[model samples]
Target: MSAALLPPSLSSIFSSSSSASNPYPLHCVSPPFNLAASRPARSFLLGATASYSDPSDLSLVSPTSDLTVQALDQKLLTLLRQRKTEDAWIAYTNSPHLPSPTCLSRLVSQLSFQNTRSALTRAQSIVTRLRHERQLHRLDANCLGLLAAAATKAGHTSYATSIVKSMLRSGYLPHVKAWSAVVSGLASSGDDGPVEALRLFKAVTRRVRKFNDLQIVSNSRPDTVAFNAALNACANLGDSEKFLQVFDEMPQYGVEPDALTYNVMIKLCCKTDRKDLLVFVLERILELGIPLCMTTLHSLVSAYVGFGDLKTAEKLVQAMREQRTDLCKILRESGSEDLVENDESVFKKLLPNLTKQSDNEPPLLPKVYAPNSRLYTTLMKGYMQAGRVSDTVKMLEAMRRQDDRSSHPDHVSYTTVVSALVKAGAMDRARQILAEMTRIGVPPNLMTYNILFKGYCMQLQIDQARELLKEMVDDAGIQPDVVSYNILIDGCILVDDSAGALAFFNEMRAKGIAPTKISYTTLMKAFALSGQPKLAHRVFDEMLNDPRVKADRIAWNMLVEGYCRLGLVEEAKKIIEKMKENGLYPDVATYGSLANGIALARRPGEALLLWNEVKERCRVDKEGGKSDSSIAPPLKPDEGLLDTLADICVRAAFFKKALEIVACMEEHGIPPNKTKFTRIYVEMHSRMFTSKHASQARQDRRIERKRAAEAFKFWLGLPNSYYGSEWRLEPIDGYDSDSL
Candidate 1:
């Protein structure tokens, strides 16, 4: 067909001008395959929709059928060469029979190269179709590996797993890149993804071993990259046992552990709380003569900083600064030796026992690495975490003064300083750092401005936050993302500006920025706190309608809080029931809000029921059947919730329940506000038994209430006395007797 007469989709395929810009150009010296000599060239377009015929069945292979199959195959190939993968997929699926394996493989390769969700889905479909047709063996190993990589890159790791399994079943040991991509993908994936990655690693090792035992010469054995990915998974999961098992197996495969391996092991140590083993990693690296990389150095410094041992972290950095090679010796001779002594057995079990070095052995650290911007930022983060704002500023200044260009601060380094100042409520200093970023040509990014927005919001400076957001757009030309709007919404909450919060939320949607779960919950919080429970409900409904955001436990709790804040106990209860229907049980915040609502509604019986549910989830001490700190429960209650419930019980004269709550608090290491309870007791129940009751049953109930009150007073270390008289309850000698 002529170019002007061709459809738009097919027109691009024949546009020879596009070949100049095509990144994946066809390097064929001739046409891909032979066409029939007598077939008329005019049949190319007309034969596209010709009657279907099975290419595998020779009886149906007429000249016209052959022409149609060849025409479709050639079209698919041309589309792939032009990088029109989507259109190529459409053409492939519309064909009556499978295209030639070469054309099919090219189509799969091109689609996989796109690495988009839709493209990967199509690639997976092709792989599945090939398997169904029993022609999977036709695809080359390189093409299969590309499909696996694409599936992994698109976050469909399970699909990648199936592709590898097919490759293995077909007697093709997958290439290293194929299985390694799957491993790395699962390792970085959250939740049980790391565990599955580790499992896949073991499966691959076993398969390789089986091949070896059968005398099948296979080069597809797990290599260093594969082992590192598995080890990283172990680190993420804090599975020290699996980490050691995998580390010990590396040598059997003739794979030497590299610096990245040791770095991952360092992460495992920090994650598993074996900070004492940090030095032993370095020791083992030295004994094995592994060349140290900058990442390993960064890991060592970060580990110490993570453990809050700033003195040791500083000493290590200072040693590197002075080019001293005695870091291990210095650490061993210093107070860290005591830490090692305390965890000696732990270190031995986690790592191989270090052999005593002979006198001829080289120094423990062969070379000292100077700190880079990343390493310096890590140490500065330690200062930030420790609340030493001045020291963090000093570290940034030190980075600027360093002569080594590698040590000069980057955007991350500057952001750390801003984060520190923001945390310390030093917004002015934070802005100064931002100005410096622009002055030095390291123009502030969205994250830098977001931090400023958060700082302003936290300080209830909404007008300032607004001005910053405007500057971030108009001056910096950076649009506000979901996080920026979420921060502003929360700022509106702080200033009790619910309408303002809604306006920002609407504006965010108007700009096509999807609100995350945080945005919805923050806006709900604004409405809840502003006493507009119905508006909060509307926001919650909108959040439910949003396909992108899922309603998590926090979102449900915010809805419940909205109703509970207005003393709408029944509505809150209904929401909680709905929350349970969604498979989310009430957490501490849910119960806390309910407790507040019950108090506001003066529903003491509801408080008692809520307490029953909470008590069941609270850990019980075996000693006195009280809640324990050592044993974690399914729902550990915070002090705010427990205190709120206890106050309700005290006000309603549920003295025995009040005593139980106070005991639970003490067992959990939370000191009860005895003075507050005592004050409530005096104010609400001062004349509890003064009135005489005509009915004997009523008098007996009064006696029980009086007895329980006296017991509660005794627990609070206050002397019980008749309240109708001038005498007042007095604190015992040991009690501080201060008001809460």
Candidate 2:
């Protein structure tokens, strides 16, 4: 077969080259080539030779050129057949003429199959070369699909998408495995990835439909896996509407929803804050007779825990522990059945929306799943979140008492106990949990120690945090990661120790641990809080220079904060503009810092401008303008920011603006601090309008200010009348009226 692949003239040359007695013939005779030439030069030479061997212009090709092309092709084929990918790549690149489509495809298949970064790069190079040569269509579908999957696995989702799009543009529909990989990769990529994943899914579905109508058979039609990937993206985005749209489209494409499909639905429910539909989803799953899986059960418990409905989560876990097959009975026992029943309108938007079962309908039943360490840990997490330290400890004890080995407390369980204790400010108890973990042979990982470090840091016990860091390395032989350093840096910020924070930052770098965005941002925070805005700015600049870390919103906000902390409102506003230029709009924290800076700078007019911008961003266009969609979602001002701005307005005697800020506070459900404002008004404006100016314009301005003051007093529910004396000159018992 190898001999047949070669041209007759080259076959003899290959036979001569492979002579066992003279195996190193090329080395012995430097015939027509420079054997010492670089590999790239050899490739260029081969390509140049192959160009002359084209069959379309055979008359122009000499037999010598044909022989050279055949010899190179044979070499590439032999190397590929032996699975020597590196050598094959060398031979293929050095060849003057492109190899047969079959040979090229086989090479690509091998390279992609290796799944190493270098091999994937070489495979992508081959594909790119083929694309440049307008021969991409010659590669087989399986080869292209494998390349796409390999790229996706390597975290190059955009590259993978482009490959799939290339396949489509070349009139070849990609296989499900190919496009699905791209979709799943995009979905998990974070940021706007999920949105793009949904778009890709829809694009391919449309193409498949179009092809089906044209009587073309294509395996690229989205299957259950593809649909699930799309659904998971929706769950990530909290797009319940898009999720349902994709979910309902499954039946139209003849794809059945699987257990994972329903699992994503449960997550979507949690994400969209529709916890009331949890039971309804379970009922629908039961109605569809889908086999229950442990993940679905875990997701339900996790969703309930996230919603702070720990009772429902506990009931489910308890039922599972008791091996109750009728899980619906557990739902009823938890008393959330009524809530689910009352929310039919919520459930109807999804599937079956089962509320009350028919007389003949079978009840929802689940397999008896023994509670695993993860489920118990999740419950413990809920307790930790709710500040129930004792309950979290008890839950850990329950896990230890469970009979099943899978339910036995693990490192995560121990870590949760430590986290709960730390959150409750019981640092000693948290350390004791660490000791218990060591005693029980469950090794505390980096996360456990980091949690303790954070606990110590939060209490401003930087010394203990440092001690723990040393212990992590020397005692446990566990190296501190980026998170450990971030915690320590933040700890320094708490105590206003910028130098200490910088020491930790340098030490972290010295130890070869790359600082992440969090590390840089936390360090910036240290400098910012210490009133060293220049140092913070320097750190921010360094963060931008670091290739590994991208400055996120927090980092930008910290820079704004540093400037604002020093009452450098102009510098802060410049940073904000730069932040917007970088595609990040100022969020609540950004505005909060600016408000504080404005108050510090005594710039009430600037406060009014800031308020207008805030109001514009927060404006809801009831008319559904296209411009509104382009605007960022409204900024939800926290009480601190609102109070800062309002205080500035009140102090500056900008009473009308002050009233507007107060109204905004009430609109957002934050009650204005009337007592504080009333005190400020009485102290600052007690003698207002007492004297009239001689100039008419000055008097007119005074009158306006007084009326505004009166309106503000009226709003504060205070007396609008003046405090000046009409009958207040009388002396009490032993006091002198003249002196008063």
Best by lDDT: 2
- lDDT digits (tens) for residues 584-619 of candidate 2: 889999999999999888888899899888776656
Clashing pairs in 2: 43-94, 46-96, 47-96
Worst 10 residues of 2 by lDDT: 22-31
CA deviation > 4 Å runs, candidate 2 = 1-172, 213-219, 333-337, 340-346, 353-367, 435-441, 461-492, 495-527, 530-556, 578-587, 612-638, 663-669, 674-701, 709-740
Q: Model 1, poorest ten-residue lDDT window?
A: 41-50
Backbone steric clashes in candidate 1, count: 0
What is the lDDT of every predicted structure here? Answer: 0.75, 0.75
Deviation of model 2 at 579, angstroms: 4.8
| Model 2 whole-model lDDT (C-alpha atoms) | 0.75
Compute each candidate's TM-score over C-alphas: 0.75, 0.73
Candidate closest to the true structure, highest TM-score: 1
